[model samples]
Target: MTGWDISPAGVQSVVSNVRDAADAMNSGITLYGKSVEGAMTSAGTLSFGTDGVGGDAAGLVALALAKFVEGTERDMAFLPLRASNSANGAVEATNAYISGSLEQAWNAQRQATRAPDVTAFLEAARKKAGEGR
Candidate 1:
């Protein structure tokens, strides 16, 4: 009992804080990219799209379980057979890629909508002004 200096609750809190920071780091990068993607992308807090990372991670988990369940050879999707895919790499590239692409697409849509055809606008204005003629 003397050798043990920390409580289980303390260890749990540390784990939670680290997980939150990592998520924030990933999210911040996405925001920075969104800023650059202003014209070619979108900047938003949320979206309606597939989450490749989550899905892929889930796939990874299933893969690991399936491997353990089937006791078969390691597939490329779940690589590093022995110790590579620890399944602890919480966020997967698959979900991130999907989410990122949709964000970009959404931004592109916004840019397109904001663009106005000045010539057409002027023509309409002039036509309306000369309506009597």
Candidate 2:
């Protein structure tokens, strides 16, 4: 078995690291949300009409702006949702890792404290009891 630094301090450090990563993830989420908000605001501010010279060029510019706004709005709407999903996934994975590590440490400690021949001893005791019956 690989050596493990399965002390209380070690576990606490791991948990703290996970929390730090989560804090970073939260900050990233906030930033992504702000970006989405900015994109939406920009899309809202886009003018879809003539730009002084009302001609084919103006129409093309307007069309391009409309398309840009549509794409920006759609992308912005989904950006936060995707970032939220990614953050949630990170938290879930972290929780799972912590839980599994702690559980394995606990199990290892329990095993270390148990006699290697405990099962054999129990079987012998059961056989003796059966013989007495």
Question: Which candidate achieves the best lDDT against the true structure?
Answer: 2
Candidate 1 stretches greater than 4 Å from native:
1-4, 39-133
Clashing pairs in 1: 41-107, 42-107, 51-95, 52-94, 52-95, 53-94, 53-95, 53-96
Return the number of clashes found in candidate 2.
Answer: 0
Please give the lDDT score at residue 10 for candidate 1.
Answer: 51
Model 2: residues with Cα > 4 Å off, grouped in runs:
1-5, 45-133
What's the TM for model 1?
0.26
**Quick one: best TM-score, which candidate?**
2
Error of 1 at 127 (Å): 54
- On residues 12-31, what C-alpha lDDT tens digit does candidate 1 reach at each position? 55546655665665466457
Task: Score each candidate by Cα lDDT.
Answer: 0.40, 0.50
Least lDDT summed over 10 consecutive residues: which range in candidate 1? 81-90
| Residue 45 lDDT (model 1) | 29
